[model samples]
Every structure is written in C-alpha cells, then in structure tokens.
Target chain A: MTIRSVAIIGLGLLGGSIGLAIREKLSEVTTTGFDADADVRGRATANGLVGAVCDTAAQAVASADLVILCVPVGAMGDAARGLAGCLKEGAIVSDVGSSKRSVVSALEEALPDAIVIPAHPVAGTERSGPDAGFATLFEGRWCILTPPKNADTDAVSALTLFWQELGATVELMDPDHHDLVLAVTSHIPHLIAYTIVGTASDLEDVTRGEVIKYSAGGFRDFTRIAASDPVMWRDVFLNNRDAVLEMLGRFTEDLTAMQRAIRDGDGDRLLEIFSRTRAIRQAILEQGQDVAKPDFGRGSKEV
Target chain B: MTIRSVAIIGLGLLGGSIGLAIREKLSEVTTTGFDADADVRGRATANGLVGAVCDTAAQAVASADLVILCVPVGAMGDAARGLAGCLKEGAIVSDVGSSKRSVVSALEEALPDAIVIPAHPVAGTERSGPDAGFATLFEGRWCILTPPKNADTDAVSALTLFWQELGATVELMDPDHHDLVLAVTSHIPHLIAYTIVGTASDLEDVTRGEVIKYSAGGFRDFTRIAASDPVMWRDVFLNNRDAVLEMLGRFTEDLTAMQRAIRDGDGDRLLEIFSRTRAIRQAILEQGQDVAKPDFGRGSKEV
Candidate 1:
C-alpha cells in the first residue's frame, strides 16, 4: 500500500509544504502540484515545490495514487469535483483542511467513485502562499486522519505511512470529534486572536502606533496568530460553525467570569484560574508539543 | 544626575533582568537587590544578579541614588514602604509594574519624600523567578516612563538614560494614559489568553491531552501567554480595572459581531476582519516589536 505518486491541489502553504515535504522525505515518490492561480503555479514551479507543476488540478491528479486537496475547506468540493474523471482508478482522495466533518462530506459528495480519506495535518505558520512554505513544515507535527465509516483500510494505512515518512505522527479520529477538538484547540483561539487584534486596532484612546510599539507587553503574540490566512480561516469558521460557536460560548462565559472578577476585585478567583493554566503549558512542553524556551526563543535569534 | 548606586526591591524576572542588564551594560553602577523571599535572595546572590543581594529592602536601598520596585503591582506599596527610612534624600523611586497609575500612586504615597518616577519596561517572558532573568531580555524592547508631574527633570532624564543603557528604548507617557494603553496592549490580551486556556482545559468534549497535542494549531501561543506569573497578572487586573474593563467591553462587542457572522454564515464580514488584522501584524514587525520570521523562528531552532 505504498504511495507511488502524490498530487497536491492548491499550491499555498499547506499544498506547497506537502509537495516539498514529499520531495525531501519521500524523494522516490512522484510529486505534482497545481493551483487555481497562475501566478502561484509559476512561483511553485520556480521554487521547485513539486517535481512537476501541472496546469490544472485534473492534470495533477491524473497519475497520482494519493490526491490531496489542499485548498480552503469551502473550496474542497470544487477541488474534488475538478478531479472526478481524471484521478487514477484507485486514487485515495484526501485533504489537509482544518475541520474534518465538512471536508469529508464535501469530498465524498464530489468524488463518489474515488476513495476519500480526509486528514488534517495540525501544522502551520501565520504566513501563507507558495513562497511561505518549507520542506520541514510538517515535521514533528500531528496529522489526524478521519476516514469515513467502513472505508478501505489499506488506503488509510498507505496514507498514514505517507504522512509518517514526511515526519508526522498520525492519529485516527472520528470526523465529528476532530472538528470539536480543533474547535477548542485551534479555531476558537484564532477567532479570539482575530477579535482582540481588531479590538486593539479600533481603539479610540490608544493609537495604532502605540499598540504596535508596546506590543511586547503581550499584544504581539496575538498579532502573529491573527495574521494567519484570512480566506482559509473564514472558510474554517463557516465549515465548523457549530463546534466553533460552542467553544466560543464556553470561552465567552469564562471570559465574562474573569471580567466580573476584575470588576469585583476578586484577586483570589483571578489567581486561581491564572495559576491552573500554567500546568497546561507545562504539560505541552513536557510532551514536546511546544518549545520550553522563553518567548519561543525569539529573544536569542532575532533580538 | 548620574545614578551611581541603584537598589532593586524584588529580585524576580523583571528585577533580576534589570540587575543583570545593569551589570552587563553599566558595569560601574553599583547594584543591590532584595526579595521578600529568602530563597530568591539566595538564588540572586548565586546568580550574581546584582552587585549585592541584601537581606532586607531597607538595607538594599540605604545608600542607593535610585530604587526600582520590581514586585507584583499589589505588593508595590509594601515594597516602597520598606525603603522609606533607608533611601538617600534625593533617590528616585520607580517600578516595573504592568499598570502605571496605581503603581505611581502607591509608590508616591508609600515614599512621600522620594522622587517617584514610575517606569514600566514593557518587556518580559512567561518564565519568571530569580533564575529566569537574563541581560538581553530588554534589548530593543520599549520601556514606558510615567513620571509624576513637576518631578525633578534631571532625575527623570537620569532614569530614562538608565533604561536606555540597559538596551531599552524609553518613552514618556502619562500614568493614566499608560494604564489605558497597556490595558489593550497587555492586560486584556493576557486576560483573554488565561480565559481561553482555562475554557479549553475544562471542556468535556475536548480532552486536555488532545488540547496539548494539537496546541501547535494555534492554542499553544495562548498557553505561552497564559503561563505568565499569576500573582503578577492578578495584580495587573486589580490595578488596571477601569481600562481593562473598557477594553474588554469593546473586545466583547467585536467578538459578539464575529459570532453572529459565523452563525449567519457571513463569510464576507469574517474575511474583512481577518484580513485587516494582518496589517497590524505587519506594523508590529516593521516597528521591530516582533520578529519577521514565521512562528517566531521556532521551526528552525527547536524543531
């Protein structure tokens, strides 16, 4: 069940990274990539993001044993539909969308004859587009596969092994559960970051210059997250609405309680919550989910 | 008005960094430090965080021309009061608290005769304690000085020069304005981060292990901020109540709008807000407040 050829649809951060990762870690496997944007296609070709930069999505998936749709979740259906008659007879169709439930449904609806195993490699940076990606982007990261009920086991195993070879730890989870987990762990966080960064930008009392200057006080961190791909995030919120809203409700309620504590001068209550959150960070570092160095070691390298 | 001798009242992250920075940049300036906790005092001595780690706050400030209180905002009053009888007649008293108005009042009230020029080095890491300090922590970071009205000009210039010598760019700001500005830039961001991390930890649908495992998706950034010193944050909320609440109200309104957009499937509105926030990140990078590299350059260094 080894993947002989991989096709990446949409040469953005995720797509370009997948192409480059395949070239670097799975050099023996043939890689081809395509983007709707001709400029991106030109850049991808120039950067050698893939072994071949195809003119169309259909051309990319024609010879691929594994076809991964790497566009925004909202565009997954179109991306999948474009490959309807072009994909190899046994091609396993997959995607690297943030949310899994909608993506799985979209791919299944579009590619009725092709095998679809939706996966989300939980890795990214704030930057996007063809030049923003690197070969090592997926290394040491998690890639959750959400195979449909009673799907082909061999196809799933091949995809898992492919991701593993690209330096990712693979996990299998239900599509619904993956959406809910990502809602809390990823979606809501990005939403909150976007909201706060906007809030700071629109302030009447504080100038944008001031916010930018004193950003080291803590605001800079949110700016990085808030700077992530807008179209990708917009589609994420639309596709994972229920889970995102549910997580947002919980976050808003907790934030309300914290606001009340601040207004009421409940130092003890504030201390309790603040104290407990540190343990979660410790666990994250212990599991190697994040680096333990201060300010993500930004001080040493940049400053 | 060259500051010949300086005393640091709390030998934690901010205090210890100040001491080390002084040693590295202004080697001839005598530096003495004291922490309420004897263990921290011992660590300060062992680490050579200052020229002398005094046993008492009074002993630390006896002959110093300047005194900087580096304790939590809630403890600034007591720390200043401890130095009342021992400070030199014309010694300038300052602090490194997040919020400035309350700190200015607390220091002025506790040391009526002292030249109080409260300053906040808008720089730090989540890591705290005596051993967490480093000489370059303030390098190229902003330090806002909120000196009292009619304060000695020479003393203010000397204090500003002192921060500059430590590799920080200093700016003068009104205490109240500083509080309001910091509420958006630091306090509210921290409160939201703490709230989200807490919410994620308490979710029944999402396991803590899952949250940690998938943190790199975006949640881990909030966790780094949430891991900041709890007592310090607790005091920040308590002291900067009005500004934080005001900013929180605006943030809540914006978040509510985003929630409604998601609920109504308004992709255009979501994209607009998400798109605009990227400009702020660009401004932050252009100002040298944050690194231009992706993921704060974490990928190249640690992973």
Candidate 2:
C-alpha cells in the first residue's frame, strides 16, 4: 500500500514543512491538515502548507491513507486520540515528535487497530508556527523511524520512502534507542541553552541590557536554541524525562568538573577536555550535519 | 603623539586581524607584529597580516607608539614580560584578553613605566591561529576599554578612537565589571558549551557517530562553540575563575530548577522560562549583535 493521501494534525513548523515538502516533491499525493490554533490554520491555508486545511482532524483524515501527528511530545496521545474515532482503517499513523518511545506508546494506545510507526525527522529551525517552515527544512537531514515489532513492514517502507522523497535520509531504529539518542543530540542541548540564557538574564551584576548588547561574544548562539518553541520543548522534556534526566546528570557532572578545573587553575585538564571536544565538532561538520563556516558563517563574510 | 605607528605582540586571530584591519582602514599607519611561533610570523608576513612581521617582540615595538598584546589570558603576563626589556618608553600598552582584571594586573606589574590599558574586543569565531584573522572580524563588534583609574585621559581617548577606526563601537568599563559582564556573556556560555559537548560524546549508551549525525537538532550549535581554540578558552576560564564560578553557580541552580520542572512535569514553569528567554534573542537581534537569519544563517546558502 502506498501513501497517496496524507493528513497532518497540528500545522506548526514540522507539520507545515512536511505538507509543503509533499506539495513540492510529491505533488501527486493529496495533503490535508488541521491545527488546534485557528490563527495557525488560517496561516497554513494562506501559505498553502497543504492542499486542504480542514476544520477538524477527523475531516482531515477522512480520505487519507497516512496520518501524521505533529503536535508536542506531551500532546501526542491527545492528538492521536482525537483521530481515533474517525481515522480510516489500515491508515498508517506516525509522528514527528522528538521522543519516539512515548509517542509510539501513545499512538498504539490511541489507535489500536492502525499501523502506527513513530518517526522523528531530525531537522528544524528555531522558528515555529505554520509560517516558519520551508520546503528545504528537511533537505540533507535525517529522519529516524521506529516501528513496532508486529507492525506491517510495507507500511514502514512506504513511510520511509515518503520521507526520502522529501529529501531526508531515512534510518530505522528501536523507539527506546531513538529517545536516548535524541536526548543526547537534541533534548539536553535545548535544556542547557534554556538554562544559560535564563542565568544570563537573571544576573544582578550584569544588567539585562548589557547581556543583550554583548551577546555576540558567545551568548547569542545559545539564544537561538533557547528561542525555540517553548511549549514544544516543554513537552519534549516532560515526555522524555528519563533520558533527559540521565543526560542532564552527566552534563552537570562534567560541568562541575570543568568548574573545579577553572577554580584550581588546572589549565592542562581544561585544555585536554576542550581539545577532545573539538574533534567531535569536526566530525559533525565532516558528516554534513552543520555548516563548517567560521562563526557558523553568520558574520564577517570574507571581505 | 598622534598614534602613527602600532605594534602587535601576538600574531593569533585577534592580533593578525588588528594588523589586517589597520592595513585596510588606516593604510598610512605602519603596523608591525611578532608571534612566539616562527610559523605564525611567516604566515603573518606572507598573508600581509601586518606591514612588517618582526623576528622578536623588541623589533616589533622598537618604533611603534602603541602596542597591543593579543595572547591567551593566562599568557598575558609572560607575553608582557617578553616585551619588558625592549618596550619603548612612553608607548601606550593595551591587550585584547577576554578577562580584564587579571590582564590589567599582569600588565601593570610587568610594564610599570609604560601606560597600560586593557581592552577586550568582545568578538571571535571558533577558528583560531594567524590564518584565522580577517579585517572585518571587529566590524560592528564591541571593544571595551578598561583603563586604570589614574591613566592618562589622552591615551584612553587615543585608544578608543583607534578601536573606533577599526570599526568596533568603543565603550569604557571597569575591569571588574567587564569581567563580570563577560563572565555572563562569554565565559560561562563557553564553559557550558564545552561541558555539554563533552557530556554528549562521553555517553556510554549512545554511540558518538549517532551524536555527530543528528547534531543538527541543536547539539551542533554547541559543538561550534566547543570547537573554539582550546588553549585560549582554558586561559579565559582560568583567568576569570571567580566570575565564571559565580555565573556557573547561578546557571547550575537554574538548570536544577529546569530539571525539576521536567521531572515533575511542570509545564507552566518550563513554558514561562522558555518564553522569557525568547524575548532576549529578539532583543539581541534588534540590537544587531547577532544575525537574525535562521540556523545562524548557515547551510542552504553555502551548500
């Protein structure tokens, strides 16, 4: 069975981007979407994020062969339950949530008879909402799909192809492992970003205006990550608590060690750890995961 | 003196960039430079980083009216001591170290007879070395001048005008205040970035390959910062230990709060803090401190 008609619930950055990508790359497939926010639905329609902006999730899924919930990780269960009453039989259910383990469980419980496969297309900008997405958001990105043990193999293959057609490399992994990997790669990073930004602003010695003015020194990069959709990130942490806590613990330990090294003037230890970390960034750049341009290529374009 | 001739005692990114900037903007000014590494001096000469790359610090400062030390914060004392034997009397001295308090003490102690001023151009990229310097690196950036209380006003004004000529907006700040502000804005952010990248790579459960492949989700941003010059950052943390520790303490407290919120599923707290941080990013962009483009304006355009 091929994914010919698709329904997207929650027309935010991920959902809207998927719709636009489908329209750009797989125009033969009919696309329908609905958002909880009326303003987002209006913007999605105006932007042509999908072929049709339906008034309800049920209406959106009525004639679709594939349904993808793009709501927050914590809201996945509720979003999936909203489609359970009217979803087409044998339709493949999936999501673009960061945490796959909880999302898979939510979809399975909500849509018992449906072919549910949890997937996280590891791509996005700091921006959110219907207007924030672009067709190329997933280009050269990775999409990890986690299917249940007894799920239909053909459905997983079709979904994988759909994402590939949208320009993302696809890989299959266990849902638990997906959660753990994302915790390291995505969840903990956001948490640290949010924490530092909060800390910078809360300082009594440094005025908020001064922090904003001198942010270019290094604080500004973290602000981009901290500026991500609050509700979405909030849900991600809550839904993936175990992995996040685990990663955060390790991060805190390492940070404490760094603080001690600084206090004790252990320059060698500091240099060793800093030097080791540089190799990881090099590897990330080599894999085409990030732009190799200096200062992330944001400033001082070679004159 | 009208500040006609300038000397740079360290030929790293900041030093080389100053040489190139002076050559670009103030073509009439004679600029000479020297580095501890002969290779960097050769590159500085070949790349035209300065008008003349000298073999020794004495040769670099023999005829210059102003001299700027551009070495690691920890190396400022040693680098200054290298110039003590031959530093021309009445030549106003300054440095481009991130931490001002220690650098000021080091310079004042090392060069008692020479007028010493500490200036930090709060700008850089992850890349380093002589080859990493560019003329426009200081353009639209902030250069904070931390002159001693008893310093000559004319010397301060002259240095301020020089940085302004280099295209950076100049501001006068107390060395202690500068260290505190930078601790919040630069030092702690870098420490946090280095810590998170270290934590991510040291994970026993998730393979390093997976972290590198999926870094785009946000981990990659930290890596860019983590990839910064290790020796330089180690010096920064060591020199600014008190302020860094203070800020890190605050950051850890805030991170603990966030961790608790996630563990307890306190969505309201998470959403509140996250939303507040977004406004800071907006302000930073409004102030023109950071590029407003998404993803740090990387990828799509270059690739």
Candidate 3:
C-alpha cells in the first residue's frame, strides 16, 4: 500500500520535529498531528508542521498508515490506550521515547493485535516543546527500532522506511538491549547533569554566579545538559530506575576509586584512564558521531 | 610608565590564547613567549602570536615589563622561581592559573620583591597547547585578579588595564576566596565529567560507541568536558585537593539524596531541585555568560 498519510500523536519537540522532517522529505504524504495541549496543536499548525491538527489522539491516527507516540515514557500506556482502537488496522504504532522496553511492553499490552514498534530516534537537546523542534534534528542520526519478533512485517517495513526518508540511519534491536544501552549512554548521564546543576543551585549566590560565568572551563557543559527538560528526565530516571542506579553504582565506585588514586598521587592510574578515554572520543570522531571542535566551538557562535 | 613588551610563560592553551588575545587586542605591545617544548615556541612565532619566541623562560621575561604565567598550577612555583631574578624589578607579574591563593603563596616565596599578582581569566576549553590559542578567548569574560595588600599601584593598574583592553571585565577577590570558589565551580565538575566519561568508556565497545553517537542528548556535553587536557586537570585536582574533596563530599551527599528522591518517585524533590537550577542558568544569561543559542548550535565542529 502506498503511504500517503501519517499521524503524529504528540506535537512537542520530537513529534513536531518528525512532522517537519517528514513534510520536508515525503513530498506526497500528509502529516496529521495531535498533542494533549491545545496550544501546542495550534503552534504546530501555525508553523506549517502538519497538514491538519486534530482534537483527539484517535482522530489524529485515523485514516493514517503509521502513528508515532512522542509523549513522556510515563504517559505511554495512557497515550497508547487512547489511540489503540482508532488506529488504522495496518498502521504501525511506534514511539520516540527514551526508555524502550517499558514503553514497548506497556503500549503493546494496552491493545491486542496492534502492530507496536518501539523506535527511538537518538537525537534531541535539553530544550522541548514545539518551538524547540527542528526539521534537521534527526539528519545523519541513528533511529533504533525495537520491533517484537511477532510484530507485523508490513508495519515494521513502513516505519523503517518512514524514518529512513527522514534522513536517519535505522537500526533494529531488541527492546531490552535498547534500555540497557540507553541507560548507560543517555539516561544516566542526564540524571547526573541534572543532579549536579541542581547541586550547584544550592550553593551561595556569589559562588553560584562564578560557576556559570566560568562554565566554559568545564561546568558550563554540564549546565547545558542539566538544562534539559526536567519532566522528561524525571520520567526517564523513574522509568529506567534499575539500569540508571546500576550505572550510577558503577560510576560512583569508579569515581571513588579514582578520587582515592588522585589523593594518593597515583598519576599513573589517572593518566591511563585519561588516555584510554581519548580513544573512545577518537572512535566517536571516526564514526562521525562527535565533533572535535574547540569547546564544541561554542566560543564562535558568531563564527 | 609605558608598557612596551609582555612575556608569556608556558605556551599552552591558556598562555597561547592570552598571547593571541593580547596581540590581537593591543596594537602597541611586543610579546615574547616561551614554552617547555621548543616546537611550541616555533608554532607560536609562526602563528604570529608572539613577536619573538624566546630561547628560554628567563630570556622571555628578561626585558619584559609584564610577565603572565599560564602554566599548570603545579608548575607555577617553579616557573616563578625560574623567572624571579630575570623579571624586570618594577614589572607587573600576573598569572592565569586556576587557583589564586596557592599560586600567590608559592610565588610569594619565589618573587619576594616583584609585584606578583595572581589572576585567573575564567576561560578555557578541553583542547590545549599553542595550537589551541584564540584571539578572543577572553572577550566578554571575567579576569579575576587577587593582589597582595601592598601591591604596587602602577603594577596592578597596568595589568588590569591590559586585560580590560582584551575585553574582559576585571574583578578583584581575596586569593583564598578565589580558590574556594573555583573548587566548587570548576574543579569538582571537571572531576565528575572525567569520571562519568571514564565509566562509559569502560562499557562494552558496542554500547560505548552508541553512547558517543547519541551523546548530543547530554553525554556529549560531558565528553566535551572530559576531552579537556588531562595533564592540566590532573594537576588542578592534585594542587586543589582539599577544596575539591570538600566539594566532592557535598556533591556525593546531594547525589545520594537525589537518588533516593528519584527512587521514591518524589517528583516534588526532583522538580524542586531542577526548578531551582533554571534560576542559575537565568542568572548566567543575565550576566551574559552563556549563549542562549542551541547548545553549540548547528554547523558546529563536533568532530
């Protein structure tokens, strides 16, 4: 079947961004969008992000070949239940949530026989909402699809094709693997940033002021990460509690060991770890993942 | 007295950048630079960061009216002792070192008669060496000067004016306060970023690769911070051990409490801590320290 119509279940950053990218890429398809907040729906429509903005999640997914749930992971079950019945029979229902296993498990259980595919487009910033969304957010990024073994082939194919059209390199993986990987990569790092920035906030005003002013040295980078949407991160930390805590445990143990080494003037240990980390950065550079620019080239916003 | 020439010891990121910024910002002065690495002297001279690359640290400061030491904090005392006899008797001696009190304390014994003013430009990046220097690194930033009570008026005035011309807002604080402030702000945070990135690097290669790829979310920020010059940071941690460990203790306690709050699903605490953080970001914004643009923005040099 020709994919001429699609639905986006959340008009915030991820969903709105998908709408922008899809509209830019898929010339013949129409994207209908919906969000729980009416103002977001209006903003999405005004920005020409979608052809139509629907009042209800069910109405938005109707007559559409694919539906994407782009809400917080905590709201996955409720959001999936709202659209499970009205979604087109062959339409692929997927999500752009951070934690995959729980979202897929909850959404899949909410509606029987629904072709639920958990797809996470590994891209975003600390910012959120429709205004924060951009068309190129997913370009050259990885879109991971954790499709169940028994899921519909046609649905998975459609979802995969859709993401590819949006300029993403799609990879398929098991949901359990996705959660563990993301827990170490994205979830735990974000939790630590938020917690650190939160810790800095409680410092005396004079000391706190200097923290932000001299942030370019190192701390400012954490602030940018910490500035990410608290609600979204709160949900990720809560939903992926086990993996995060596990990573945090490993992280703290390593940190304590490193601190002890530093206290003991174990320069060799510090240099070894520091040098090894450089290779990971080099690998990221080789994979065309991270930039080796100057301070991420933040100093040259005008340049 | 007219300032005719300046000397920059330790031609690394901070030192080289200061040379570049000074040469770019001030038209009249001649700058003679030196580094432990002879190749760095060649690079700085070829890059026109210095009018002449001196044969040695003592040679660089021999005829100079102003000497700025930009070496790692651990090397400050040695550099000061090396140049003490060579420094022009009435010349203004300052530094861009991370810690003020320690640098001043060490230099006090080394340069007993010279007007040694400890300073920190409150700027830098992960990159290092002469190649990493930039002309505007100090533009719109703070250059903190901690002078001894009996510092000569002309010496302090000339150096303060020099940094002001480089586009920094000069601030004065007690040297000990500078150390404590930087302890909480820069040292602790760098330690955390380095620790977390180190932890992630130890993950299975497959997972580690994905972490770098999706790092844009939050982890990338830490990597950028982690990518900092390990030797310089190792020295900072070693020299500032007490203050850093104190901050570290506070951070650990805060983190454990935050972990409990998340495990308990206490959104109020999560939201409360996160909500308070936005204010610090706001304060930085008002101070015009952080750019309001997307983190590093698009078209950045990440790789």
- Write down the worst ten-residue block by lDDT for model 3 chain B: B294-303
Tell me the spans in candidate 1 whose CA falls farther than 4 Å from its real position: A300-303, B299-303
TM-score of each: 0.98, 0.98, 0.96
DockQ of 1: 0.77
In terms of TM-score, which candidate is stronger, 2 or 3? 2
The true-versus-predicted C-alpha distance at residue B255 of model 3, in Å, is: 0.9
Candidate 3 Cα outliers beyond 4 Å, as residue runs? A301-303, B204-206, B299-303
Chain A TM-score, prediction 3: 0.96
Candidate 2: tens digits of C-alpha lDDT, residues A218-265 = 999999899999989988888889988988888888888988888898
Residue A256 displacement (Å), model 2: 1.8
Give the C-alpha miss distance for residue B196 in model 2, angstroms: 1.2
**Tens-place lDDT digits, model 3, residues A1-303:** 457888988888898888888878887899898899989988888887788999998888899887888999989899989986797877778899998878988987997778778999888876789887777778777899999888778777878888889878898988777787888778878777777777776776346667777665566666767777777877787788877777888899988997797788887787676666666666666776566666554554324
**What is the TM-score, restricted to chain A, for candidate 2?**
0.97
TM-score of 3: 0.96
DockQ winner between candidates 1 and 3: 1
Ranking of candidates on DockQ, top first: 2, 1, 3
Q: What is the C-alpha lDDT of each candidate?
A: 0.90, 0.89, 0.79
